[model samples]
Target: MAQVVTCRVKFIPLQLEFIATFVYVYNMKEDRKELWDHLSQLSGNHKEPWIVLGDFNVVLHREDRLGGNPVTLVEVTDFQNCIDNCGLEEIANSGSQYTWNDKQDARIFSKIDKVLVNGEWVDQMPDITAHILPEGISDHCPLVVQMLQSFSRKENQDREAMRRIQMQLQLTPLNATIQKEEKELSDKFRRSIYLAESILLRKQSNLD
Candidate 1:
């Protein structure tokens, strides 16, 4: 009953657009072909920015597994070939490196879960971070992806200073001042985003 969920997202105020496809692949090896085919078809013709994430139930290399039977190249190649066919690149994640663990008598751990994106998505969010959270109620860990923040060395220092200030102010009424300042900073960021979006729309309308 598990299928893929595909949706388009548009940040109307920012006029930014991207598509996301979430897949819960078949667990059996033979059924993987069907999963690969479904993804390949979606990624085939268009270059729209896309991010696909889920339990793929397949791995691409030896290091992706620990203990149990070693996966043959023949087994891994199908998933690799499918990624190649779709021009999808896997997003590297930290935290729980491996996603699934068969903790029975045999005991096996595998990195069969993933988040992948196309080159266009890479161009859009070059420093995107895909992080893995704890596997709470399932065998597979949850993956979270977000755009990376860019900052100058001075800016980083400034943020660290602000963090220290916030920590210190936590015991004082100045904490209210810090909170107000944080709200103002957030509003400024939103305003900048709106300005950028207006400029993008204006330029696009001019071209039209």
Candidate 2:
């Protein structure tokens, strides 16, 4: 059976900390129950923000597979039981729904790979998302997890400060002293605009 790895991650800028668990289940049906039991035990121990993700080698639902033998309740019960026991929720994802595809004329597609998080994780990072990239050479597609932190309060404060500065610049006469203040404020305003644009560009790039 594949080993389960757990680590603590700290986001320095946000002063946030969480537990991240990575899993790779052995592909055999009989071996998976032990893995599920182990994961459930781990989940019960961790109270902090936690995320577990990987190729589980099993589908959670019938909809998660296509062009394969019909998914039976017996095949999914163990996995579903583990999920409920762990209190883990699947992350919202974009791009392709199916993460694995057997490259053949009679193709088989399944969403065996997933990103799951606890309630604490959702409370800490509400905007977290997963993107499933197309499978190239490999049979399984790549999963890109993105955590978009909100800096709305800081951004709003900066915008308000800039607006006040602009009003002062517009109302004041262009004397030598006022001209110098104008130059300083203009530089600050331009810097803020540049920073905002940079942030927007970064988000757009992530989406692409």
Candidate 3:
């Protein structure tokens, strides 16, 4: 079987770390743990914010699985411990009843996919939501998460306040000079009109 693929995306403005992984079916236990451990070590060491998401085949609890048999007790406990020990939080798992279905058997269904994140990343990020999208050709339902990346309200308002202060401070002598020049031009136009009228009056006096 082919190995799972992992990728990272760094958004500079938001100072975010987005780590993505896709795990294949065979040897899910060791492969998922190895992939997760790599991301988890990075999360622990780095001070900057980060989020991790992928197809984790093992379910953490009975609630995580929709209709599967509750027979794998030890595996479920180990998986839940892995998530907790890595300090990742699962977000919005109620959208789909199952992520994978038994092709031969219609009644058996299970959810083994999820989106997980750390605490620091969730604080600044908003409208972080996920839904199970339709996948006609594949066995796995597509996990879709809408990431709204922008400055928060407090940060934006703080920037506007600083801009107002800077503008007020810079509006000192140059603006005053321009206003004075405008008034002087008006006075010069009035004086020219008066002089023209006086010249016309003198010519009329001479004619009389």
Candidate 4:
């Protein structure tokens, strides 16, 4: 019920090793129960930062269905139970209440697409939000994630690295040795700044 693609994202020179999983899930409840089982087993496999985004082919609540036959409690429970079991938190979206639409009728609207993240991802990106885009060629509206990572990361990393330097300096007693370490730490700090700036420039360039 899921076709998964994995990729390693790299920023040149920094050599950060980050892996991203792109999962496209088609959970047609009538088609199979395998998907429900898969969702139940997913959260146990990941204990670190992660995100899941795509058309889920399911809606969590009655509000997710705008003009369809009144959503059944069974339907809502089926969709939300998977989310709850997997420990995935849906990121609140702005701009649109629903994503999927029946091509024939504007009245038939449903929010089946979403962006879900785990506890670690939430801890790292508390300010992230999902941006629901206008419907395109497909019956589904596109979605974009507005992330605070690029803006907040450099500041937080710099602060933590400097804190480490400060702690090391405090713990080392001898004045001459302290100055020596301070100079070394200052050099390392400058390199960190340069790397962070390079990454910032790349992000700005991409945005432009």
* Candidate closest to the true structure, highest TM-score: 2
| Candidate 3 structure quality by residue, lDDT tens digits, 31-57 | 556655555566667544355665666
Ranking by lDDT: 2, 1, 4, 3
Per-residue CA lDDT of candidate 2, range 94-169, in tens? 9998999999999999999999998766544435789999998999999999865453444455567666766776
Count of backbone collisions in candidate 2: 0
Tens-digit per-residue lDDT, 51-114, candidate 1: 8888788887889999988889988888998899989998767888788887578768899888
The TM-score obtained by model 1 is 0.68
Better of 2 and 3 by lDDT: 2
Window of ten residues with lowest summed lDDT in model 1: 149-158
In model 3, the runs with Cα more than 4 Å from the true position are: 1-6, 11-33, 66-68, 148-208
Model 2 clash pairs? none
Select the stronger candidate by lDDT from 3 and 4: 4
Runs with alpha carbons beyond 4 Å of true place in candidate 1: 151-208
Can you give the TM-score per candidate against the true fold? 0.68, 0.71, 0.58, 0.64
How many residue pairs clash (N, CA or C atoms closer than 3 angstroms) in each of the candidate models, in the order given? Answer: 0, 0, 0, 0
lDDT of 2: 0.79
Determine the backbone clash count of candidate 4: 0
Cα lDDT listed for each candidate? 0.73, 0.79, 0.58, 0.68
Which residue pairs overlap in candidate 3's backbone?
none
